[model samples]
Target: MKRRDFILTAAAASGALALSPVAATAAPMVFTPGVVAKELAAGKTVFLDFKASWCSTCAAQERVIAALKAANPAYEQNISFVDVDWDDYGRHEFTKSLNIPRRSTLVVLKGDQELGRIVAQTGESEIKALMDTALNAATM
Candidate 1:
């Protein structure tokens, strides 16, 4: 290939790679209440995202969590994420059990114990702090 053409192709490929979702982020697996129960029973750390599709705060939190996971794969691996779709399942039994007050609640739990929580918070630092609480509990 000509040098100019090769350079242009390489740059395009690099841009595509940089913009790829698989390269930029690692999304946590979605979990149901049953899975949360099982994981908790097995002494796993859990990050429960109580969210609604219409809630912008929830989307912000999701982005923060995704970024955090992408940054710290080792820490993320020791935790499980459960996205409770409050838009559809807001009134479910697990919501009642957790006493989740709204659509933007993020509950951190280690086993049957509550570690930390955030309600309608979008700050990345705050979300990371909340997640750190669960990770700390897991190590204890």
Candidate 2:
């Protein structure tokens, strides 16, 4: 193959990869209490991610949430993710009020109603299903 042809092929491949699923990443979660309360009051699907920076399961769940949201962009509009940093904000009054048992816990709620809860779950399918429960509940 010609050098110019090789360069063109590589550029095209890189562009395709950029548009692929491998480039998909989860969106950032909300960390503000006032925003969370406002979203809930507005009847949005709320996801409380009780996480610590040092927790592996929390990291995995974060990835799973991102991938799911990437596949279903509607989740961005319908779901409001509130990340509760157990390492920094563990003793915060709102954290205490949520009654999170441990780090890496995911609590899904629609307004005031609890939809589903998962603790230290790393399975992508299971995590997506759990999130789907919240999505399904939100539509109803």
Candidate 3:
């Protein structure tokens, strides 16, 4: 498939070719797994990354995540990183699952309470801050 000129907003996703129930159906983005929920309930911290394949911001964030993961093995071990596919990812259902109307939404949840959410922005520093916050929450 041709790369989209730009990452589409969740509003634009209803018309996304990949999201078509006809041509194809995308898998939902799962930032945190069931285990994460359980761990968080047990006082663990979890970081869920809601992203898409066509989103340029997601691609850039991937680099930052790689570096972060490499820099801190403890972060990798202590925190659970869940990558939820946003684009074409099970339209409507997944959208509702997020309870949000947009893609590129990064949410940090301490158990069930959300610490922070980043939407429609690609600032690495800000994203890093949110991730850091989530990691801290898991331990707290």
Candidate 4:
């Protein structure tokens, strides 16, 4: 292919990828001590994602969650999504308190009550159901 044609093709592909749904989805808030508690105290429902950067299971779960959120904007609007890096907070008191067993854990919390949880499962339907539970709790 001609250099100019290749360059233009590459630029077009990059722009398309940039505007993809996954790319447009908003990222969850990075976990910070007291942030979860603060959200709970304010009566907002929270969806906690415990993941590690290097874990394949975590990556799969993240993709499912992102897709679910992209499909349903209500999940993002009603639930306070927080991402807790397992490497940073795996042994932290907060994780221990929630009884999170491992990195690919997803938990939904509402006013000190855990509405639902998923561990290492990356099925789209399952993740969507979990997200639905969070949305229900949040709207309640």
Measured by lDDT, the strongest candidate is 4
lDDT of 3 by residue, 29-77 (tens): 3543354557567776666666778878777776666666556555665
**Which segments of candidate 2 are over 4 A away from where they belong?**
1-7, 22-26
Residue 93 lDDT (model 4): 99
Instruction: Pick out the ten consecutive residues of candidate 1 with the lowest summed lDDT.
Output: 21-30
Question: Per-residue lDDT for 23-51 in model 2, tens only?
Answer: 75445565766777787888888888888
Models sorted by TM-score, best on top: 4, 1, 2, 3
Point out the higher-scoring one by lDDT: 1 or 2. 1
What TM-score does candidate 4 reach?
Answer: 0.87
Q: What is the lDDT of residue 66 in candidate 1?
A: 81
Model 1: lDDT to the true structure: 0.82
- What TM-score would every model get versus the actual structure? 0.81, 0.80, 0.63, 0.87
For each candidate, the alpha-carbon lDDT, in order, equals 0.82, 0.80, 0.63, 0.93
Candidate 4 local distance difference test against the native: 0.93
Model 4 sits at a Cα RMSD from the real structure of 2.0
Among the numbered candidates, top TM-score falls to 4
Model 4, residue 70: C-alpha shift (Å): 1.3
TM-score of 2: 0.80
Q: How many backbone clashes does candidate 1 have?
A: 0
Residue-level lDDT for 37 in candidate 2: 78
